[model samples]
Target: FQISYAGATDSSVQFIFYQPIIHGWRETDFFPCSASCGGGYQLTSAECFDLRSNQVVADQYCQYYPENIKPKPKLQECNLDPCPASDGYKHIMPYDLYHPLPRWESTPWTACSSSCGGGIQSRSISCVEEDIQGHISPVEEWKCMYIPKMPVFQPCNIFDCPKWLAQEWSPCTMTCGQGFTYRVVLCIDHRGMHTGGCSPKIKPHIKEECIVSTPCYKTKEKLPKEAKLPWYKQAQEPEEGTAVSEEPSFILEGWSTCSVTCGVGRQVRLVKCQVVLSFSQSVADLPIDECEGPKPVSQRVCYSGPCSGEATEYTPEKAELLYGSLQEFDEQYDWEYEDFTECSESCGGG
Candidate 1:
């Protein structure tokens, strides 16, 4: 005999299962020391693994697995063995053929604005170079055109603030069966200071809105977990939580090519700022009037030294023979050379 059954609409079915929490961590073997013999350094790093497939993941994942484990050092000194003596050539200190020229240098960074989360920090950089007399002199931006300028803005101290601070709420703890609410609670003072002022009893509730109902069917599609914590917070509590806009400020562009390659010369470059009306516009596209802050120096003196490679060095006597008198020689050939090559190579060995 065969039996057939029909079910009414809206009938419900429930299944229960448990997934074990997984923790995985590992340290790589040390790499070969950097130096051939003398002293050098070696390195290694700790990493986390995916429990289900045993594949390597980001190191941060390991922290949640083996709770309370301390971080390990990734670098160490090694290769203490001494090197053999060199074969006869004396070691001479190397020097840059070009003189210590002027260039831009960035000062040390200032302290972070806040102890946690988001805050702004900045540093000042200036053009500088050494003069022929061995003195450090502040040069015009143009004189330091060889290198790119350093940026003055950067982010710092971006980790999660602390436990007392209120974090946004998590999704409803359960789909439909028995649901509960959850959120992050940080302990801190009114001024956002990491203090114990928050009373244990008054802390925002971590669980709420409980309900027992039929289980809702879940789809196989899932959203990936967020990887980074929010880095910044508003300076003041605003209703919309929008960021305050800073006034437009001028930022200097890298120096342009020198107008003249050698001798006392000059160079010029355009400077611009982020004008409110020119949002997302390239620097060159912004009009000069849009630059609201202090205008950057558009032109500056660039001393590349007297034009070189034009004339070769020759003895005073040789100069006199060619130009008749020392006075005449000096007048006609103010620029001089040390010696004429067997073939004035620069002059095609004339």
Candidate 2:
């Protein structure tokens, strides 16, 4: 019996083929551990590969065929070893990885901020920590546990200030005419040190006019009434005089004019002796006598006005003459100054 197989193909027939199929996934080698030690992780990636070309390509190129499939994660844990101990780390519990403790530090102080008046200066304060290699690193302020921070602010250039200084008033420039005097004003401190910080508005006045305007003269009330009368004319009573005898007395002349116009000067008066005999004889030709009385003063201090300027002073020449008496004449003498000229300046202060 001849039996035939259903749906059979001839041995000599050929088939057409396109791209190769993506059968399975391949993973890259695990990269270096993310950290040296103390519980870090390592990573590896999964990708699709072409079977014929055997080269890495884009996922879409491999997905041209329906057999291509997307890859999944291929990561695993690494660096499970414990960390070494160091002084830079702080102790928390018994067994655990060490971490650095934070501390505070400061930089050098800065220069003074102001030039003359009060000023302030500052510096930077930073929180830092030491690493395992003994290198300093910056950290947050909150991490610096119990360290006390340094003050960033300070004072500089604290001293006294300079002020305006005025010299004493100077002498007037002229003796009898309008004139002015001047003094020096400077900027200095109380210690006589100068720094030139004085204010211009508050400086003292440096120049002023002479203030005196008139001469000084004696008042009427100051003179004695008896001093105006001649010594021989003065009233005197003898003890019941048995005989009337003429007694000699002194005669004083009026004072001369002052030698200066507006400053201290000198004046003098001449004295002469006269015989008293009822005022009937001429007294001008009377003889000198050794009278029993005090001698008169001829030289005296005189002030014309406030002392100022320069003037030539003259010395009075004295001469003596012999008269009718054998001994010496007793004469009363006094001196005074004449009125002074007007002061130099009319206004402004002196």
Off by over 4 Å in 1: 1-98, 165-202, 205-350
RMSD of each: 39.9, 30.8
When summed lDDT is taken over every stretch of 10 residues in candidate 2, the lowest stretch is 318-327
Give me the candidate number with maximum lDDT. Answer: 2
- State the local distance difference test value for candidate 1: 0.49
Report the C-alpha displacement of residue 296, candidate 2, in angstroms: 50
lDDT of each: 0.49, 0.50
Assess every candidate by TM-score: 0.23, 0.31
TM-score, candidate 1, is 0.23
Show model 2 residue runs off by greater than 4 Å.
Answer: 1-102, 132-134, 189-191, 199-202, 214-350
lDDT of 2 by residue, 1-350 (tens): 23344455663434445543544457767767644655444455656666667777776665665665554434444665555656343323321233344558889889888755668889999988665456898865644434457889998866556777776775544333333455667677646765467777797776576644644344665333442212133233111222322333455666688777765555565554443323233232233332224434343435566655555442122111111121132233233333232224322321
